[model samples]
Target: MTIRFPVLIALILALSAVGLTYEIAAGRVLAPFFGTSLLTWTTVIATVLGGFSLGSALGGIVAERPRAVALRNVRSALVATAVLMAVSPTLLGLLHSWGVRGTDGMMLSVILVFFPASVCVTLPSPLLAKLAIEARPGREGSSLGFVLAAGSVGAIFGAILAGFVTLPLIGSTATFAACGVAVLLCLPFVRGGQTGTPGTTIAAAVFVVFAGLAGTPACQYESGLSCLHVDRQGPEVRLVSDGTMQAAESTAPGEASDDGTVGLALSYTEWFWARMDRDLGPDPSVLFVGGGGYTLPTKLLASRPLAEAVAVEIDPLVTKVVRAHMPRAAEMIARTGFDAAEGDGAGRRLGIFHADGRVYLNETEQRFDAAVMDAFSSGSVPAHLVTREAFARLREIVEGPVYVNLLDRPDGPLARGVHAILRELYPHVEVVHGARTSTGRTNVLFAASRLPLAPLDSLPDRYSPARISDARAFTDDRGWVGHR
Candidate 1:
């Protein structure tokens, strides 16, 4: 029943790795329902950490038992942990189906699905360490140190594995299953542990495999950045990322707008272009900060064949999906590595740069006739992209009017904060609403330029200039827009 010290250390490392993998992968698993917002990440992280803390406490009590009894419990815990981790994807899906939502529901679901498995994976660590110490009595310090070091090292390895390798390569469902199988595989290494029946082992293995195969994937295409999928909304195909519909375009054959351009499916897009047409000159050069589905840029290329449209999208996979799935987006342009700033006299051209919008703005020398701030991470605009410093850089690059699209509560802090900063840089700043005043979230647009924005005033539901004295401007250091 004796296990070597090196083998014991390796087992602890593997167990800790599995535990952390589950923690990191939980965000991607919850994204389809929660939108991967700051709130979702915060809740997931806290709940997992809470479970680990509770498990360590439980492990301390169990470690006080006799060596044989403690080791026996470790084997049992690992098997149970494996079963729980394997079933987590299914549990989350069922919870979501039953209408789990909002901050409270998110917390409840994480507690129910992720918390217990975290506890089980961690509960054996102390037990294993206790056995290791008892086996080599005089080497207690080094044994304890090695056990702790193994857990820490394993955690680091697991994080890198999930973020860079497995989650992106195999997707979240497979990653979760792999974590379970890893925990189960640790059973044999526990010194003095009871040997479970072959039937039990086979049953656990089958359940893990079934769970891996049973769950519907969160997206058609998943990347480190998002869970991306294409959805059909009547005749239009929409690109959805992390549960938020980023862009939509009409798929109906021969469908065209009154302006003889490809029809835009989203109302907010229609309103944005209508206002920008007045601000932007003929044969205009446009810069899109975020190219979700590339709907607006495609419309521009179709309507104004002479116009130049450059889109800087962060995730290449998203643009890839848009080209393959969305209507007309496929025929628009090939992704060639071109300098987005190099504006040689080309009659009509489209450039798609896969980089952070803010970073692209900072590095590019190309100035544009107009710019659109449409970049977002899930439901929230990435805080970095909306900072005052980012806007100031954008202002320098874009000479004509700049249009921004965002979702926030009607006249919410984010809308007001963006308005405040834009006003500081531009002489004329206006807010246009895509929806009537409501308690819930809605699309809000901010138009800013050095010149008078007369067109924005004509748009329906113009937000009356509110006293924004209390609205805190978002800076690079502190960008706290209200959480959706």
Candidate 2:
């Protein structure tokens, strides 16, 4: 009896770990469709937790009669969850197929797919706990603690495994599938003594069909491919491929850019390079936070005097694409004898660090003269990168002026947000309008520095539009102001 209790406790812990892993995996699975945003992640987690809470409560009520009944309920819940987990992606895809794309679509999809699935999976926990206590009433506290500890350990493993193995190996969809399979494997163990209930079996089978249907691939729209992610406002679509966002476009069919650059278009590359040139000058030591297509790096090599360049991109797939597509940039680095190696001189002129930009910046002792924040897009600025706290950290590593690319509309809410942030961080800040296009609003560049900038009129001819005339000064308290 003692051995059985301990074993059951261990199984419960494993199941909890599986639950947590599936929640995270679900986020990644939805990233391609929704883009990994704070709201999206929050929705995923909240739905899972809510589902877990609902399931556990319901399971407790249903299992009140006997240990056998409780165990049966738990097993049924687990199986149902696995099946729902498998089917969610397909449902989201179907929603997309019906021309239902955008933030509202994504939020609704998550609620539909993730909420019930998580709730169903959550049913086992309370019942399992009750059973554990029933089996060994005297050691209830110890058993509960052990189960929780096991769950904590499993959660740690799940996070590590997702990062190192699942995501890198199988892609997001496959990772979710693998997690669903793990939960299904636990069903037989949890249902050890329980006879198959007809109603439970029917529900489980239905979920299985749903999962299979969800996993089936459907025809994805060409334009849809460009706006890889749908943000909540539902009107704006951020273009992403292989995890990294390339650009953003409107969702309205006619509202989108007819130009090639509208969806994953390379013209944004030229525009980005031009902005970099405008601010950083021809020759500048640059630190690029996110390497989208390595388009900017390639252009910098040709147009600017890049004394030293460092590209920190989180996604390996993006780096691979950059290497493949932007051969010239790679060749430049190779010729300059710049490699990933750490040291001084020409051999160390360029380095590509495949790590989180915030992590890399935090850890590196090296500083750059020009830190270009070109990574902002799709109404998402890595919270860490945009915060006043992060600006302070960047101030420590960067000696020269910092250039931030603002993708918000000239006077939109996003632009206001950027303006507010810049005001808090830098004493001297100015916004420069980049190329305007008919396809979308123009991109704006915000130049910030601790040092006082020359008056707008004093800037040379190269500083066209005159930073003073075109620029709006921002105060930490007042936000963007036309006059000082």
Candidate 3:
């Protein structure tokens, strides 16, 4: 009886470890299609927790009878969970490809992956507890606590394994699969475990059918303004758009790009370089918050001696894609004056850190001469990146002048928002509207600094034909106020 209790505790711990690993892996897998936003993570966690609760409640009812029957139920539950976990990622990939873009698509995907998998996975604990209690006949509290503690210990190992070993080494999908396999392996060891039955066969067939439907490929259209490509790479349906790559499976690839550099208008990149050439002197140190095509980085190399240039991009895939497809950009980065790093690294003259620009600016002790807020676009502006609080953080990190690219038209939402935020944050801020092109919209340069604003007369003579217009003073509190 003593031995049986300990074995049940071990089984519970092992099942928990598998569950926690699966949760994190699921988040990474969904990130490419839905984005790695707080909303998406919240949905994933909530769904999983809800599933766990449901499974526990249901398992308790089923296991109220005999010890042997409960043990068999627990084994069945583990087997079911293993099957679901194995196929969840593939299912998510299909849903994402079926024209499911943005927040709505992401929420649905999370529900699909987490609901069934968590329900099956969570059943083992209660069933195991019932069996242990029936076998020992008394002292349920002490026995259950020991089992729960073991499960907690297993959870800690699972988290560590997912973060350090599984995620980094084999990638998310494989890690998830491994976790599922671990759960399946546990089934055979449980007391009263059955080998195969007609019911089990039917369940397996149902799982297979669902997996097939989920793994089926769907066609996608690409927008010419932004490059988009979809390919099945192993367990994931990889979507690469505008040099940014995301994996659509319950497991995220370690190389997925999280920074806000992809899908940006090419005109923004070109205009930014042109503006940099006009406003800043040659061989100056350049700090870029978002790294896209390395368009500006390459141009900086061509035009200047390249004293020092730092690009802080959060997405490793953007950096990787630029390096792979854009040789000129990569070469420019390799040149002595340029340093490419993720957004988290510290810097003086030049360094790259893979981190949030707002967070980095607030936390960084280093300062830059030319800090560019090249992080936003027309469709979506990262609100936090453009908030008054964010600008205050930028002010602390910048030593000289700050240049921000605003997606604006004659009267655009972005332009209005830029004007409002700038008015609140800077003592001296000026907007330089550029010419409209074939591309969707024109852009405005919002130049601001704590130092005296450079007068139009004192501004460099080489300003592009794009920048011919005089700086406009924006005094509206409501963003996009004039447009509405």
Best by lDDT: 1
Candidate 2 minimal-lDDT segment of 10 residues: 218-227
Candidate numbers, best lDDT first, in rank order: 1, 3, 2
Against the true structure, candidate 1 reaches a TM-score of 0.93
Tens-place lDDT per residue, model 1, 164-227, is: 9989898998888898889878876775655667688778888887877876776779988889
lDDT of 3 by residue, 109-148 (tens): 7887679989988877777776666666668787767777
What is candidate 1's CA lDDT for residue 26? Answer: 91
Error of 3 at 194 (Å): 5.0
Q: Which stretches of candidate 3 lie over 4 Å from their true place?
A: 1-3, 133-138, 193-195, 198-265, 314-321, 337-350, 354-365, 375-390, 405-421, 428-446, 450-484
Candidates by TM-score, descending order = 1, 2, 3
Error of 1 at 268 (Å): 0.7
Error of 2 at 93 (Å): 1.7
Candidate scoring better on lDDT of 1 and 2: 1
The TM-score measured for candidate 2 stands at 0.73
lDDT of 2 by residue, 1-484 (tens): 1226666676677777667777777776665565666677777888888877887788778767576666666676777777776776677777767865566777788888778877776677676676676787788788778777776787777777776676555545555566667776676566545566667666665555555445553212111111232222355434355234563433345433333112222334434444455556556777888765554554455455445688777665554544444344446545553435354444455567767777887898887877777663233555556655566688889877777765545554445656666677678777655444442445566777777644343322222231323234333343422100
Off by over 4 Å in 2: 1-3, 66-69, 191-194, 197-272, 275-283, 304-306, 325-345, 362-367, 376-379, 392-401, 420-442, 448-484
Q: Could you tell me which 10 consecutive residues in candidate 1 have the lowest summed lDDT?
A: 460-469
